[model samples]
Target: MDFTYSEEQQMLADSLRRFIDTEYTFEARRKSARQGESLDRGVWNKLAEMGVLGLTVPADFGGFGEGAASQLVVQRELGRGLVLEPVTPSGVMAAAVLSAHGSDAQKQEWLPAIASGERIVTLAYLEPTTRYRPESARASAERSGDGYVISGTKSVVWHGAAADAYLLTARVSGSNEIALFLVPRDSKGLGVTAYPTIDGLRAADLSLQNVAVPASALVGQPADGLAALGVGLEHGIAALCAEGAGAMEKLIQITGEYLGTRQQFGKPLASFQALQHRMADMLVQKELALSMAYVAAQALDETDPAARRRMLSAAKVTVARAGRFVGQQAVQLHGGMGMTDELSVGDYFKRLTMLDQLLGDSDYHLQRFGEVMEA
Candidate 1:
């Protein structure tokens, strides 16, 4: 099979790459993070104008409705820049959930705005106590006179401070059935405490004390919540894999340049055979990760749920391990300066570390891959 990107995919990647290299420099990114800004509406609108924010939304909703492989192309570019925008959460994850399960009116209202970047949405599901197991959620929703009252605390909601709304997950009161709802950011009894992640991105802790929404806010039947959640997560992991690949690629370049320039014992560090071998190993890991990212992206279209799950799990495990190795080696090769905040290498390493834990770490997905193979 041909591995080259299609013309459209290559164009999209090139457009995004140019923007990152010219506009969103490392200093600009650090400035935004220092100010505690989660979503830069100006930058987001620019991305929207580029049609990137709508890459996954259906054509009926003013989007290109591109598939996972196309999404991987876009995300890899974002990763190279260490972009702080919540593109994956709002663009990929929320769009996937809405397109898959939202009602006609709901789609009509949200999709267009999301496509235009007029509004931002993200998934809020993980609880403080849930670890990474979304299925073990304790948040609850109760019927209340043609509406539902939801109460829960969601931890580390991606770009939560900037979201105009959230797709929240809650268990039906007194039942095992989990459900999804669209909660407005300004809804009464809802509180958001924003903070910067170690990776220089923003996240929030959400407090929902008896927040109420109309029955129309329900995304799908209670029984469908977990499946929908699973769909969202699978899309998220694919994006992360692609992003990790881009970040690793850039990190390797930075290390390579540093070694060629930084003198050691009256010669360049690149002259050392030991470090050359380490760089060679880093390249191998990066190639392996890029291949697995393609595997995960292609697997998104698999018709069989079991087959899809297995491929996604396998890709996640492989990419996560590759990311860990590439990140650690990149830092070590850069020496002590690599760990300092002044350099971008340390920031890339931090992002790579967080990516592993975001949608289940290497250990978790390795076990899942084994379970699926046995099944």
Candidate 2:
């Protein structure tokens, strides 16, 4: 596959890097985290101004229509900066779903707001009882006049508290039909409990007790809800793979710099052959993960669902393995300072760890990849 990024994509990468250097420095990130703030609305607005939020939105909704490679670039930069914004679950995946499945009126009403950063949206697809089953919606939706009464809780909703609305998943009553509903955050009987996550970001436990929305809230065909959910999860896996690769890259750079500057036995650790070999291993792992990211990007929107799933699982497992190797080596190379909050090394490792569990982990995807290949 050709790896040609448009000149504009490169410019976007450069621009994001500049912003990171000027605004998302270690001090700023640490201050926000220490202050118990899960997200910086200021940075969120800045990203919107930079057009990062609109990259995946459709052109008719005042967006750039950027996808795959462009999103990979943007997400990688977000990883490098340890950005706390929910751009993946909220921006990329959400925009992809809405653009592909939302009605024209729905698109017109919400997409523009999302594009302008006037509203934040997130996907609520998980339930406490379901494990990676996009279609296994235990939450029941009772049919009301034309719409449905949503009653269920979505666990571990990423940045749910900050969202203006959610694309909620539930099983329609008296049938096996699954559906995605667009529920506003201020809807009656809806509640959110926010908390910090292991990655120094935010997530919330969402409860929906008979939350009512109009029939127009339904996203895509009811039976095809699983298909839409699959697409969203695929984008999620791709994004997480790239983000893991980005964090791995930063970890390698930080480890190498630490080895060069930190003295060991009256000489720089960089001069030690043993440490040098470890750093080389880290670089190899990072590069391997990066190659998998591009491969995942290539297969992101493959028309065949089975083919896309196989390819994404393949890339996800590979990235998870490489990320673990890179993360562990990075922390080990830095010794005591590696896990401390004062150093960014620990935070990067934590983020990498969290990324592994997003969508699916190496063990989970490895089994799926093997099964798909055999099929």
Candidate 3:
């Protein structure tokens, strides 16, 4: 299959890169990190104006409806810039879930707001016990009069600090079936503890202690919650792989430039044959990762769930492993300064490290891939 970017995709990539280069500098990112700010309103609005926030949503809902391929383009640029926004969670994943399963009224209400970047909604499915398995969520929702009361704890909700609401998962009371609910952030009995992550982003731990919602809050059939969550998870993994590949690619470029300029023993580090070989290896890993990202993106269009999941697992494994290798090499090539806050290399490495742990890690994906093969 051809993985080349279309003209529109290339245009989007170029546009986002230009914006990041001029507006989203490393120093600006550091300032936001120091301030403990997760979402930069100015930047978020600009992204919306650029149509990036709407790239994945259905066109009928005022989005570009560009799908996974466009998502790959947008994510790569965000990764290169080390952006702190919640595009993956709100713009890509949540948009996909809502588009797929939201009621007509829900779509009319949420999709336009999401595409316009007026609101943020992140998936809140990960629990202390779920361990990356949405199906294992034990949160329960009990019918309360004309509504339902939900009780659960969601950990490390990405960009939850800025979310106006959450697309949460819970088991319906008296049944084994999972259900999806739109939990507003202001709901009574809901608790949000926000914190900054090591990668300079923000997350929140959510506590829903009998938080009540109207029946309209339910998304799609109560029994199809896992399937709804799967749409978001799969898209999220693909976007993340693309982001990691971009980060790896940028890290390699930065390391190469550092080797070319930084002198040792009266000669540039790039002159060392050993260092050159290592750079070559980093390049190879980056290329492989980029290819794997494309593979995952392409797999998003696959109609067969098992086959699509297997391919996504494969891509995740390759990208996760490659990210680690490339990140570590970038830091090593930069020497002691690599870990220093004054250098962007450290930040890139940190982000890449967290990316491996996000969604599912290399080992997890490898095991899942094996399981799929066995099955």
Q: Evaluate model 3: give its lDDT.
A: 0.92
lDDT of 1 by residue, 165-282 (tens): 9999999887898898889999999999998888889889999999999999999887788888788899999999999999999999999999999999999999999999999999
lDDT of 2 by residue, 1-375 (tens): 456768998899999989998988888887887776766888988999999988888888988887798889988888888888778877888887888889888899888788878888888988888876767779888999988899999988888888999988999999898898889999999999988888788888998899998989999877767877777788888888888888898878888888889997899999999988988888988899999898899898688877888889988988888888888898889999886877888888888888878887777788888887888
The candidate maximizing TM-score is: 3
lDDT of 1 at 70: 87
Off by over 4 Å in 1: 1-3
lDDT of 3 by residue, 1-375 (tens): 455789988988999999999999989998998799979999999999999999988899999888777788889889998999899999999999999999999999999999999999999999998888888888999999989999989999999979999999999999998999998899999999999888999999999999999999999989989889889999999999999998988888899999999999999999999999999999999999989999999999999887898999999988888988999999899989997887899899889889988888877888888888898
Q: lDDT of all the models against the reference?
A: 0.90, 0.85, 0.92
How does candidate 2 fare on TM-score? 0.97
Q: After superposition, how far is residue 164 of candidate 3 from its true place, in Å?
A: 0.4
Kindly provide the TM-score of model 3 when superposed on the true structure, using C-alpha atoms.
0.98
For lDDT, the strongest prediction is 3
Error of 2 at 205 (Å): 0.9
